[model samples]
Target: MTPLSHIRNFSIVAHIDHGKSTLADRLIQSTNTVAERDMKEQLLDSMDIERERGITIKANTVRIDYTAKDGQAYVLNLIDTPGHVDFAYEVSRSMRAVEGSLLVVDSTQGVEAQTLANVYQAIDADHEIVPVFNKIDLPASDIDRVAEQVEDVIGIDASGAIAVSAKTGEGIVETLEAIVTELPAPKGDPDAPLKAMLVDSWYDPYLGVVVLVRIMDGVLRKGDQIKMMQTGARYGVDRIGVFRPQMQNIDALGPGEIGFITASIKQVRDTRVGDTITHEKKGTDTPLPGFKPAQPVVFCGLFPVDSAEFEDLRDAIDKLALNDASFSFEMETSAALGFGFRCGFLGLLHLEVIRDRIEREYDIELITTAPSVIYHVYLKDGTQMDLHNPADMPDPSTVDHIEEPRIKATILVPDEYLGDVLKLCQDRRGIQLDLTYAGSRAMVVYDLPLNEVVFDFYDRLKSVTKGYASFDYQLEGYREDNLVKMSVLVNEEPVDALSMMVHRDRAEMRGRAMCEKLKELIPRHMFKIPIQAAIGGKVIARETLSALRKDVTAKCYGGDATRKKKLLEKQKAGKKKMRQFGKVDIPQEAFISALKMDG
Candidate 1:
């Protein structure tokens, strides 16, 4: 094992598209952790979606052996973190496993919303931060300007900041040396009681469940019985290993080291993230300070395209959840969608990632409802209820008031677009908190209702700013609002999955827009179908889809007047009968498409 003084634990944090994964690849390659022939772009991004999108969804941990300029061998454990706000929980877990972070800021983009958010988290954790200006190979790179922004916005020293281009392998050696000299070595006693925090875990077909952990104190090895402090579940360790780009079996993992362990556990829930793992026989009296379990902020229902695939969808979610602890689901039945699951996600990106994964990995096409935020409903009798699905909300008469989740949103945009950006926020019922200038960009902070931004705020923000704005937000707790539950009825039958909790002022406009979108999506039948949006028993908006007509007079081309009249009467009777018995068959796509409307 490497000596304590020669060990360095650090993570790379930055905004999306700031070259985090690329930097990770360059570091791994520089350390010779993986052979040159085996190298790939974005090596740390294991998922195909992550590589295609150029973003890290899950945090990846790797150990590297580096020889500093002093001719001394050093061991560096680098944790690669996701750059999006949706994966902030993953970032927090990664931060806990490391003692320092390399805060990468794009020379062209400067400090973005996510960049500040991540830096604040690292600061709160009291981790050493080494600011680095990345992508200097670009012609538009402004190193000095961004370095100044770092000092001005993040309140960090800019003199020591290193400039590197991960894509071109520029200044990488210097960056590595800086990490060794600047970051503090982790401090822990190897002889102490066992207290390893399980930061990440996944289910393996051959190994059952594989967990990635950081040893806070004591040693872990194969054949030892381990206990999860949170769940109080124990399992015999089958294998202990470290990630040297790939898993390699190790005899033991000591304190201040990061590694993986596989126990004969079948379920992913059995070995959860943020759970403390300890040696059964020599366990510590207290568990390490691990984060609380991640709570989902956004929710939507997922249904298979085919009703018979309901069971397949359930099993797929179970297996997928084993790999993603942030995703959650429960059995949910929709009158329009049939049998499905109500799924919860950390944010919009998380929802999209899981949806994409299900379609790609499971080979199942699905219909997803509009995403909704959780709400708190207070009853007249002083009762409180948490509502995840809008259809589950009690009658307005029984409720004293309703509270909806709010977020402290931050937007970083060029100063030229400040007026338009502020206007957009104001239109969304946002309350401006503060505004500050960071070089050429304006950082605007606001308190906005979560639901208002979940659907299309990002898209609109980009549209209004011409794709120059970056946004990040965190839940700011719940606040009382004039909220009402709106429902969509097709042919006078309510669709539970189409229900939504909307602000009272925007209810009519949103309801009308939803009805119009649904009218276009729902296929016309023999009878006219009425699609209405309602609040309680009152209809707020309505749209009628005319019936599909058939030509009954086509065969009477040369018939007499009397004969033509008789045929017309017969056709009328047939049409009336069909209208009385025909049922509107709403397709799954209609429900999905209708819910996608943004008012």
Candidate 2:
């Protein structure tokens, strides 16, 4: 039997930019998980996109050998999880592999909404939580206040909160010691029927599907036949290996150990995270609990400006979804924009990550439409269908009744912005649910439709309150309401390019604002362009912008052939970058700014 003193399993959780990754870096360095000279910065965040975004999207597991002050070596399995709500499912799944978590709190930004959300998730999983106040080195930090908030919210006495600077490597040794003392060792019956959970999986061009799992009940070995509880798919385990944190692999991982497994599985879908894998004949179960994907709360369509990257875009989504099961897409075509996809996401950030990955990672240029949330439309017979796609909506005249998705929104702001914040919420059809004060901060809650809150609300809240407002929303059930679908028309033809749903009461204001923003965004090309907002058959607002009348009209000369070639090459590149909307060639930055809708 292996000794309990040799094992340790834990995760680090915190809000975005709360120094979770930086602290993980310090822990890895102190533990000597990677070599002193050969260590890469943010080593756990090995993905290029993760490093660029400064967020941990995927949960990473690393095995490090740390020597306690008692002079005993321990095997510590450190798991790093994503902090964004978009990857909440991924975070919870990663948490299941560990016995405890380091709840890193920012001293300056005391107890954020996301921090509370994750702490509750940890509590639900029954994992031991250790609070740590990070960024003690920062000038604005108030460690005492943050620790009090943590203790109050978590229902744990955080008087022992470790104050550490992951940047300067101060007080890290004590934090390491706390993990060894405060967190309990993983306890499981290894002699029972073999059972394990698939926590993470990745696809390699040469190795096929590489799965990471935590053995919960029994010992697993090579040549063992395994069945997945979620899919009922069976496979013969080819090999078992324990993590060395880097590339080196070892044989035979035991219970409480974090490691990888290889099987006859070829596709990423076959090896899903949070699915139960058991000894084939010894254990049989169907539909594993805790594996259900979180339903997408927002939907949007994406199309290529060039109309040729349609296949490329589809392939990119497929490749990305291999690692990211949360992002979903379906084929769609518009008369205005040839072929596209209607993609579903958990929230706005989820949509942004997928869109950014497609363009920046896969090298595909895309034109994305405004986002739409699911709307519940009830039939006369009481049958209800959730409408995620705008095309799925029945004609307004044929519809019996329409109900839009609502969210319970909570905003934290300075005391001065309380009045303005209420006015902003009222304008967006928000019903004031509650209002309270904690010290000098104002906390306001509103029940607003998801569709109403998805667009420009974040920016508006920040602008009206001088950037002191922070907001978060949890989806509430749909409510019956009066709303209108607004569309933008170019010339006389309906443009699928510009479409949104607004409440009937505020349709005129929204439509006019959108058209005015579009007029400023659409560039001048070879002909004049007209931007018009229409509701059904009537045009509600119109704006006109002249198109580009002239560009380069110079000819190349043989005497200055190199310079002429350079100029022509530059023009071609410029033309390729500009997207042709009607007769106007709009730059990519214009589309980004239009999405923000902030002049």
Candidate 3:
């Protein structure tokens, strides 16, 4: 076991594509934690999707043994955290378990919005941050400019910041020395009662629940009976191990050490992330302050195309929920689309990832409803409730007003795309809060409705800015707005899944878009099918999908004009009767396609 003074615990935090994972890989390689032949790029990223998307979804940890110039061997525990805003919860949990962070700044990009967002989180956790300039091998890399920007924008000293190329391993030795010398060692008392913070947990098919923890005080043995402070559950540890990029069993873990343990646990839900684990017999009186429960900002229903596969979808979601605490779900039944689950996600990307995982992993075809934001609905009777699904909305008469969630969005884009970015925000009814410049790039902050931003706002932002803009946002609470429930009716029957809450100002345009999209997506019926977008009882937009007409008068063309008129009259009455009783055969694809209201 390593001494407390020789152990350094830190996490790598940066903006997307700022070389966080690559830096971790280079560090591991330099220390020979994994053999040169056994090593691979992004060794920390375990998921295939993560490697393909070039993003870290889960915060991964590894231990490295390094010998410094002073002839002292050091143990480094590094947590590679996700840079995206949606996975901020994962980053925060990882931060709490570590004492310091390596704040990687892209030399060419200077300081982006997500970089600032992540750095603030590290600051909030009271982490001692070591500034590092990454991607220095590129021609555009400017270590001096990035250092100045760090001092100017991040308000941190960068004179001693290490400039390194994580890809080429140019400064890996310097980074390791900085980790051992500059970063503070974790403080813990070995004699105190066992108190380990559960940094993360996931389900393994063979091992059941594999829990990663940081030992704050005392020692944890393989056979110790551990109690989870948050869940009040106890289990006997069967094995204890540390990841040198691969699980290696160890006898015990002491203070300031990060490792994994597998007790005879059943599921990941039982092992709450950030929970304090102590010995059942002799435990600490105080529990560590755990993380705030991750709140899902967006809600949507996911139904299986084949109703028989609903159980498979449920099982897949259950397995996914083990690794992901932020994603949530509940059983729901849609009138149009049978049994399904209503899942909540952090944002649009988070939703898409989960959806893709379920479809790809479990081989289940899914039909996702239009995503909706939680609304605070106040009634005239002085009652209030959260509105998740617009289909469940009460009558507008009893409702006093509806409040929608708002977000404080920050977008960093080049000067060329600044005008388009600003115009996009204005179009979404966003209120400009502040606008400033970070070198050539313009940083624009706006208070925008969360509902507006969730539905294709990111896609639109990327398209308009030509993929040069980086954006981050936080919930700014809720406020009353001119919002109403907009429902789509096909042949006078309301499709519950197609209902949404919209701002009264833009409800007409939104409804019109929906109506037009449905007209194209829904197949033409034998009878004239009327697709109408309505706000309450008032129809805002209408589209008529003309029926496939058969020549009823063609047979009577040679007969008298009166006979032809009679034939037409008979056909008209028959069409009216059929329209009244006809059921619109809306294919499953239509519900999924119409929800893509980029119209």
| Highest lDDT scorer | 3
Shift of residue 509 alpha carbon in model 1, Å: 0.8
Q: Give RMSD (Å) of candidate 1 vs. truth.
A: 1.8
lDDT of 1 by residue, 1-599 (tens): 66678999999999989988899999999888999999999898889998888889889999999999999999899999998899999998889888999999999889989999999989888899999999999999998888888889889998999999999899899999999999999888888888898989888899988899988888887898989998999898889999998999998888789999988898888887888888888689787776877889999999998999988999899989888877889999877778999999998899999999999999999998889988989999998998989989997889999999999999999999999999999989999999988877899999999998988899899988999999999888999999999998888888887889888999999999999888888888866888999999999999999977677677777757888788778867876787667677778778767766553
* Candidate 2 residue spans exceeding 4 A from truth: 1-5, 284-288, 379-384, 463-468, 523-530, 544-595
TM-scores of all models?
0.96, 0.88, 0.96
Model 3, position 78: C-alpha lDDT score: 98
Candidate 3 lDDT over 239-278, as tens digits, reads 9999998999999999999999999798788888889999
- Runs of candidate 1 with Cα error greater than 4 angstroms are 557-573
Please write out the lDDT profile of model 2 over residues 503-530, one tens digit for every residue.
8877787777877887877666545567
Ranking of all predicted structures according to lDDT, beginning with the best and ending with the worst: 3, 1, 2
With a 3 Å backbone cut-off (N, CA, C), the pairs that clash in candidate 2 are 524-547, 524-548, 525-547, 525-548
lDDT (Cα, 0-100) at 493 in candidate 1: 82
Better of 1 and 2 by lDDT: 1
